[model samples]
Target chain A: MDNNGFASYFRFSNVDWNNMWSATWETVWMTLVSIIVVAILGALLGLLLFETNGSSSWGARILNWVVAAFVNIFRSIPFIILIVLLLPATQAIMGTIIGPKAALPSLIISAAPFYARLVEIAFHEIDHGVIEAAQSMGATRTQIIGKVLLPESMPALVSGITVTSISLIGYTAMAGAIGAGGLGNLAYLDGFQANNNAVTLVATVIIVLIVFICQFIGDILVKRIDKR
Target chain B: MIEFKDVSKTFNAKEGQVHAVEDVNLNIPDGKIYGIVGYSGAGKSTLIRMLNGLEFPTTGSVTINGTEISGLSGKALRNQRLKIGMIFQHFNLLWSRTVIENIEFPLEIAKVPKKQRVEKAQHLAELVGLAGRENAYPSELSGGQKQRVGIARALANDPEILLSDEATSALDPQTTDEVLDLLLSINKQLNLTVVVITHEMHVIRKICDQVAVLDAGKIVEQGPVLDVFKRPQQTITKRFVNQETGSSNLDDTTVVVSELLTKYSNGVIVKLTFHGDQAKLPIVSEMLRQFPDVDLSIIEGSIHQTQEGALGSLYIQLIAEQQDNINGALEYLKTMRVEVEVIKRG
Candidate 1:
């Protein structure tokens, strides 16, 4: 309960309690915002990929190639390199390149394709018979996607986003090392640079806890929704 | 009535051109169960799918009432599909939905009002004998129960034609009969034209009034169920008939009959086939009474009741001191509208 007393016991000579709180808030905010955007964009991209995969139509084949190329290219890039590479786009979008907001472009761009691949696999795991049954019932393309594909693959989609969220948390930390203000920024600046071991340990523990919480919630959601 | 006029479906697969259905012509009268029986890959599935516009024929047309199903596309095709409900071998009930919800799916696609959909689904659930288990998910239901749900869902739209694609193939014999009974009752009660595609002759025998025996994308033999049972023209058709008659166990029957022949040197084995109303008569008893000197012994007997009438096959051994007595008994049976095949004689 006593923040300063807790800090002193661990020989936390360089620990700033106020800065640590702000940094934790920044990390949570970046992950939260980026994951929501990623879920939407990723799911749409994945649906398009799956729907167009085996299509014989000229339009669908071309769209499938373009979307597939974008996903593959973004997914192959290392997160750290992606952030550096997207700095110009980041500067244009956020008007600055040194805070949590500046990291959004790269965070979404990097994670969306990763989650999109997951989403496509999730859709593939659905029973083809279920889709056929929907078609037999006179369901339109949109109706099939909405009523059958999406609802049937909900558990997989949620678990996918949960995984993407955890990875986005890690990406936020990586984004932090380049002057984005988060727990990673705090740990790198105040712990590693200043030779303070306690600050690094505390930040690592918080990041681990966030990942655990995300996993726990994801498990419950999947269990509740997965009737199969 | 539904008609398939020179319908053929040839799929261009990776290997080459594959003819699934080859110039098949069929006439399925309204309000009757028509079966397309075949082994796997006989193109029965492809033929049935063309009725609902699920698979368009490569040539010719499938017309239900007056509408050519193969000629329609997009919304028009889909709307036509709404009128033709289909059930699968897998049941294909949505795992994410409850029994009632699954039944309401087609109604939802048709954009029926929620209250009306719920009422109609409830009625169909009861009709298919899934009355109390409306809240159960497909995973919680047994194979038979899931198929009951499938029947309920197929009937939700009150479709004029119900396409059953091996709907009872995955079920046990007892359950297959139960689903077939439900389909038969639906056909009668709703006047729905039912097209059943299956490899099982039991399915064709039990409910189908008319049957087309498909072999390698062609209808090798087709006629009324009783007529087919009485005389199967093709080898494949004979095999399907044997499936129901228990005649496929020919080796066992031969062993039993030959053993009986060995025991009685004076015995004569006659394989008697009784068709239609003759199966229910005392024709066998009359023959024995007329030739009282002959000893009558039944080896193996089976009577299958089809929609048209009963088809019975019996193997009888007649042992008499005089060969004339056995000959007289065989002649008497043949005169009573029975097909008599003399298996062996002393």
Candidate 2:
């Protein structure tokens, strides 16, 4: 394309780019906040997955079954459906269902359980023998969790977090489906409806950059922290 | 001092309730090297793990140094564990850490200062002859070296009690001896009490000051190494002693020669022990000079030094035909109290 075509398809002015920077900041804000919320929430729920024991007790079995059913129910529905279904819940909590800030609670509620299950799998991969050895060494349960289990399973945990972060980025993009103003909404309302290919191309580049940055940082952190 | 009072450990395996250790009460005196020997699943490993509170007894108490470590909890158990160190059959050196770092782990967990931890690890690495290879990982070292690192790691806490669970079972014979020698020297230098568990009779016969033979999880027989060998009470003990002293897997030629001695050799068949049983050199020549026409012909022999003392077994054929002369020879041999076994007629 000629420079005229290129300039028409892109936001080339420095001041114009700066003017739209709030949207960019909101996208970053949505992605980061949702990830933190979801990761923490999911990790906690995942621990519940491992701690339940229906097999050994009737009450534990019943409670475990109910929790298992709940986790699976949340995990199976599509994220978009989850967001739409959470509209009432979101409005109840936030007094509005349309803004990015109001949409975050649902995004986190959706992502947390998914990430938690992943954390459970990572935690289970640690050798029972190592835990037994640590116990035999007189390490307390807390010590075993801190000194043995966490340190031992950190590589998988980091990778799990990487996967979660990348997926959460995608989920944040999906948040725009509900009029949440992230790059996805920027593409939808401005780029698609307004026939502005500039917005579409910018949003695509931004999403790709977010994924690459998440992946590279995850790689570097795993390399640095994992001894095994 | 360690005392096991009627201890029994039973595990609920999928197969069934496996009695890993039956009623076993043993008194392991302070500063003595004790051996609990049995085949795999005979409860040897479980017996030792119990002493360090790694395995709690099902039906009895284990008192160590005035404390019943049987049910010690959390911080209390850890504090107890700091007083008892353990080494495993597989070495169990943390594969990620260097030899020095691995050795320093107990100290590290115990929160010993970094400088002291390093110094102690270095000293222990030197003690086990891994001084130069301190920075090497477990994967880089030989099986023997890994075990040395394990020994050093077990000693890092300077525990009064060292529990070895088949510690030398994985190494080559030569390396096993080297590790055993290192343990012996460490035992002497540190005056540490040691309890080793193994399926190998040679391990018990080589370094145990006192030994308990566990058969089907019960202490079938136990005593000083020499006493147990010379006068075994249980049939299994008899068999194990025979395996250690009666016959070695020498060439067929030696087996054939032993058969020949038992078949054709006459007079008095005597087995002479060397400075091999448990202590000083016994003057066997002075005892033998007492016999006229004794004509000692050695048929088979072995020299092994255990922790108690040096032990030896020598099979010799004697020359005597007359019943009176045989009786006299027996009389003379008994005076010296040498172990004599009748071979064959001349």
Candidate 3:
């Protein structure tokens, strides 16, 4: 602690790097699992919402109203409140509510409808003419959905997925609120509770790196699938 | 053959109901180039669209080739649609696909085998003179080429009837004529019945064997092309024909028939409408030579090439007298099928 080397007092990266590596891996795992669930469940919910419009059908009207209320309720609750409210449910589902796995249910709940609505909007934007052309060619309803309408709307869906994946990266860091061991927990506990500025600095750098990688990969996937 | 029995279409608009096509009945003969011409909002497009089962009439029956298409629903309707090919004004070829792929789309829908479809698509491409441009996307082709691709795609199924809903309306004059000529050739070579609907009389004059003038959702006038052009019954049809005939002064271009009869008081003033190679006939010269007292002065005439042949009309003064037995001789000329417009007497 000589006055001449006092600047090293705040020099955090000078510490051991193993803690940082572990925290980085936890954030990557949480983000990957969350995005996969959102992509699948969201696509299904999105398609249901589109097909079950109320104007043409009374049966669909009641179903759409119920589904719509459910989506809005989950989507309206703040992410932090959602995680706290779901502790019992998450504990029962995962057999424990404190690890990286317990956080999965709430992460999916908060993000699924958001991404699903994005998928819905992507589908609604397709040109009506393309669908008419397909029907005119004697395409069955299933064939029109599988061949023409889906392919024409692929670019918008791909772009929606890019946005959804990047947002999930942010949601994973916030998952540390539930004792999930990601960079957020490391920064919140080992740095703030231990009064160790050095540990905080390392966690901060790793989180930034994770965000950058998520964006880079998502950009490449989006560009590849974007036909238009 | 096609027939519309009391067809009517009304769209539910905010202003109440919109009657696009009224109680319209029309009979189109098989193997004839029939045309429906009308201004926008006159329902010419909506009227022709019903022929292919595209627009269902509110209260009427449409029979094509003796099959009632009005009652057909879903797959049956589409199956009927496949037998009737349609071309659009914008040439709506799929922009993402290549020229050959667009042509093969309908064939694929029909489940034609892949190998045979490829061969048929190649033959159609050559027919449209785009043999080497098969791989070109619609964005890579010109307006005319895009329309040719549309034509190839429309005829890919080898439909018995081809419906042109303002097909040439989007092309320039030269391209319009080219596409019209191609349609005429297709009609002749395949004997495919074409129903072309447009507002341009030039289209009617150029390719139609049978012409129907539509106005306000009704068939105002319809007949053989030569008869319709020569003696249009409807005011709208007359206006349309006058546009092509350049009859800017049909009222003022009085034959001066009275003056000819008084001056050459010994002669007859006659008007003849010449059509086909009949215009090239020496009938006018022979008529004068057969009656030495008669003198001929041509007033107006122009030859029009129709789907039938070279057709034209002439307004002339035949200076002759009844005393020379010219009236009986002119009666003989009528037997030759030369249309006579007797404007004055001698």
Write out the backbone clash pairs for model 3.
B267-B320, B268-B320
Candidate maximizing DockQ: 1
Cα lDDT tens digits for candidate 3, B10-113: 99999999999998889998888999999999999888778766688999999998889888888888898788888888776665578898899889888899
Please say which candidate is ahead in lDDT: 2 or 3. Answer: 3
Superposed on the true interface residues, model 2 gives a C-alpha RMSD in angstroms of 2.6
lDDT (Cα, tens digit) per residue for candidate 2, span B1-346 = 8989989899998999999888888899999899988878788878887876778999998999889989676678889988887888887666557889888777877889999999999999999899789887777899988888888888888889998889899888999999988888889999999999988888888888899999888888889987887678888888788787645454543565567666655555555554443224444454446656455556667776565565666766666555566666656656665555554455
Please state the error at residue B83 of candidate 2 in Å.
2.1
Q: What is the model-wide C-alpha lDDT for candidate 1?
A: 0.90
Give the CAPRI rating of model 2.
Answer: acceptable
> What TM-score would you give candidate 3 relative to the actual structure?
0.81
Flag regions of model 2 displaced more than 4 Å: A1-27, A38-70, A92-96, A190-202, B13-16, B93-145, B231-235, B238-297, B319-331
Tens digit of lDDT per residue, candidate 1, span A44-111? 99999999999999999999999999999999999999999999998998999999999999999999
Chain A TM-score compared with the true chain A, each model in order: 0.95, 0.88, 0.88
Against the true structure, whose TM-score is highest?
Answer: 1
Instruction: Tell me the lDDT of model 3 at A144.
Output: 63
Candidate with best lDDT:
1
Q: After superposition, how far is residue A32 of candidate 2 from its true place, in Å?
A: 3.0
